[model samples]
Target chain A: MNALIIEKTEDSPGVKFDPATAQLSLSGESRPENAGKFYNPLLEWITQFESILFWRKEQKMDQKPLVFAFRLDYFNSTSAKYIMDIILTLNKLADKGYPIRVEWYYDERDEDMLDAGKEFAEMVQIKFDFLPN
Target chain B: MRHFNNPVIKIGAHETGKPYFSHTKHQHLHFSQNIMQDNNSLNAYEVHKFMSKMDILVAFTGHFDHQMITILLKNIRGKLKTTSPEMAIEQKVYCILVECVENVSKYSSGNEDSSRNGMFMLCKSDTKYTVITGNPMLNKDIPSLKAKLENVSKMSREELKQLYRQQIMSERETENNAGLGIIDIALKSGNQFHYNFKPLTETTSFYHFQTEIEINS
Candidate 1:
């Protein structure tokens, strides 16, 4: 699968999904005016990756465990909806017997961010590894 | 107490021999001379004192645009860093302020010039920091907006979480419960927010919204 990478902006988070490393990461702030424009591609990329995973499984290729790290300092509510979508999509991958791990990183001082991650994890019924920075 | 030496309105003759309002670093005023001379004229020094008394850290009233919101957020972030440097409180305050200002910039009806005009303020009391925003909107939106606010205001944290999830999962992104912003604000402020609608004209109303984040010392 081709990697998807986007640089971080003042109002958007950096996105990196590397098939080589089997890791997907989002970092920095996310408060874009049109969040769908920024996140829709990411969701599409994830769906594409799912297709690749299924193909690999069918071909009996090595299935690497995927890791998705979320290191968001801030994201507006509009972005939050997309974030939930991203998580739900990932959870679907997990449901399909694919090994998936979610790492939620937050500043130790930002309890609200931690709480938000917790809330998302609960909503998706996923046990996320909460890492405090 | 900090003293404001500069006057908000400096009354003086312009170089062209016409009386005009002079602005200082404290404030910019374009009121008529008669208004400036009124007993209720705003004095920057007095306003500064009043702000100090009310624990107001930041206030703005003007056209809200994307650039303006970015600048305001940067300024407020700096001010909060200096005035109330607690990380968690700062994040909550910043998040709520972003929502409030962005809400105004996005949803508020255009004024005479079709610009997004609104007012925003941040005040810190002994126990909490308050974010207030006011903007002009169509009167038709009041009933639905009021109901949303009332419903969200009455929800507990758990209920808010559920609503947030439902809104995100809803098929219609732009319809009812599109109040993801309000729910987010309520959740961030620990479920403490107030809102009001003031009738401005037959077709429009002034919307006032306030959110508070507790200062845990």
Candidate 2:
């Protein structure tokens, strides 16, 4: 599967997904006027990546674990809901015995972001790390 | 300075604080006294008509429903369209409205019916336009809110940018109700935020906030 990479803009975040390394990173503010247009494709890419990994496992091929890192400074309420959706997807994949790690990077002063990470951590079964930047 | 005669000062029996005039009373007296002296000058009715024509209404209801916020934003934006054409000013107004509306939803610790709702008013002078939002807040929340305001007030434009960057870089996974958006509003307005908390009831207080953005000629 081809790698999915999107550069961040003033209004949206940058997303980088490497299928070979199974590393995905999203960084920046995400408060687009039309959030669905921006996030739907990213969610689709994740699903596709999971499918490829599942097929590889069925064929007895060795595959690396996936690591997803989130670094967001500010996100609106609408974007928050979309983020929950993404985390849940990852949790589902992890539940199926796939090795997945989620890292939530936040600033020390932004307690809100930290709390948000903790809230999401409680909901998902995957190993979640909260890193202070 | 404009001078007025026969100003009306009304205070409820329980109301205190040197008997200051309410905004509504001030407007009425300003028109009534000025109309008798200058017949052709703007009267209270004319001002009301103009304000109504301008489609500006400051609604203060003690209810923090999400639906009310949506309705308020739509109405305020509609009024701004008729009042000014500057995109920057319009954006400031939008930012202020969003911040105030969200603050009410996030805070306002009172009973359901008595929940401290806010008032939003639009006033324009010859060269500038203003949007003011006022709401009730708990007395205890004032200190932190004031400190945040003071901290932001001291920062310059570049400093505020740096502060914003640092804030983003150091954000934690969770946050308390720390009035972060108020900083954004101050940055956008290019002005110090005006705020005050006055004791209302024993368990509640009225918090007033005002900010103005210049409409460049």
Candidate 3:
């Protein structure tokens, strides 16, 4: 599968997902005017990636588990909802026997962000790591 | 003038080249009415008028929603761009507005019928810029609200940051809303949040919050 990498901006964040490396990362501010537009594509990519993994298993293609790391410094209300959606999707994938790890990183001084990560962790069955930067 | 069971105060027009009045409810009401009327779209012009009329603006009128907040923020940014043009001041005002409006959108309890059910206002003067927001909150939530505000008020800058970080690490998250917006407001404003709760009924209270950011320039 081809890799998808998008850089962060003043108004948006950066996204990096390399199927070959199995390393996915999202970082920066995410308060876009139209959050749905920004997130729909990412959601689609994740779904396709999951499908590819599933197909690979059926065909006996050697595959390695993917590691998803979410590092958001600041995200608005709209983006928060989508992020939750992404986490839930990942949890489902993990439940289906896909090796996945979710890491929530926030600044050491940003207690609110830390609490946010904790809150999302409780909702899904996926193992979530809360790291202080 | 129209009168309602609730007391309404009105102040006269602004005095050119004169010091703006503070702590006067009438002035705020009058200024708000004029701004609302003049800016048919409630665009940047109205925000500019609002900033010019008051030294500290605290509006908690029930006219904010998601769409309205977008427009309000745009207008406020426009006003800041045209007037001060300082990045820091612009950020301060923007953060205060975000906190105030997000609270209203999250907690406003009035049903669909009441067009102006929440409280929203902006105040500004030479020394400070203030935003006051009011929304209907459940009576049961009052204690927690009070506690949070009290805790926030007591924290030093470093302590607040630590607390913010701690909250970030907690594993419990709300689906669509997080109370972090208020914390962001406090941090950006560098002021103690001023708030009051007036009972609207046995089940609900009008939660009022006022936050201010000083303008050193």
lDDT of each: 0.78, 0.65, 0.67
Q: How well is each residue in A7-122 modelled by candidate 3, as lDDT tens digits?
A: 88654689998887677889986766566778878888887899877987789877777777888866764576678778877888888988788888987755657766886887
| A1-133 per-residue lDDT for model 1 (tens digits) | 6899999977889999998778999999888767778888999998889887887789998988889999998988888888888999999999998888899999998998998898888877556999987
lDDT of 2 by residue, A17-79 (tens): 999889999998665546678888889999888888898789988877889999986665446
Q: Fill in the DockQ of model 2.
A: 0.06
Query: What would the per-residue lDDT of candidate 2 be over residues B67-127, giving only the tens digit for each residue?
Result: 5655666677677667766655664566556666566655576556656465566655545
User: Per-residue error at A82 for model 3, in Å?
Assistant: 7.4
Instruction: Put down candidate 3 lDDT per residue, B100-158, tens digits, no spaces.
Output: 77766666664465433575666665566667776777778789778878878877877
Give stretches of model 1 more than 4 Å off: B1-42, B110-115, B175-177
Docking class of 2: incorrect
Worst 10 residues of 2 chain A by lDDT: A73-82
For model 2, the stretches where C-alpha displacement exceeds 4 angstroms are A1-133, B1-60, B172-177
Stretches > 4 Å off in candidate 3: A1-74, A77-133, B1-53, B56-60, B111-116
Q: Show pairs that collide, candidate 1.
A: none
Decide which is better by lDDT, 1 or 2: 1
Flag the better candidate by TM-score, 2 or 3.
3
Q: Predictions ranked by DockQ, top down? A: 1, 3, 2
How accurate locally is residue B183 in candidate 3, as Cα lDDT from 0 to 100?
64
> TM-score winner among the candidates?
1
Q: Indicate the residue-level lDDT of B10 in model 1.
A: 31
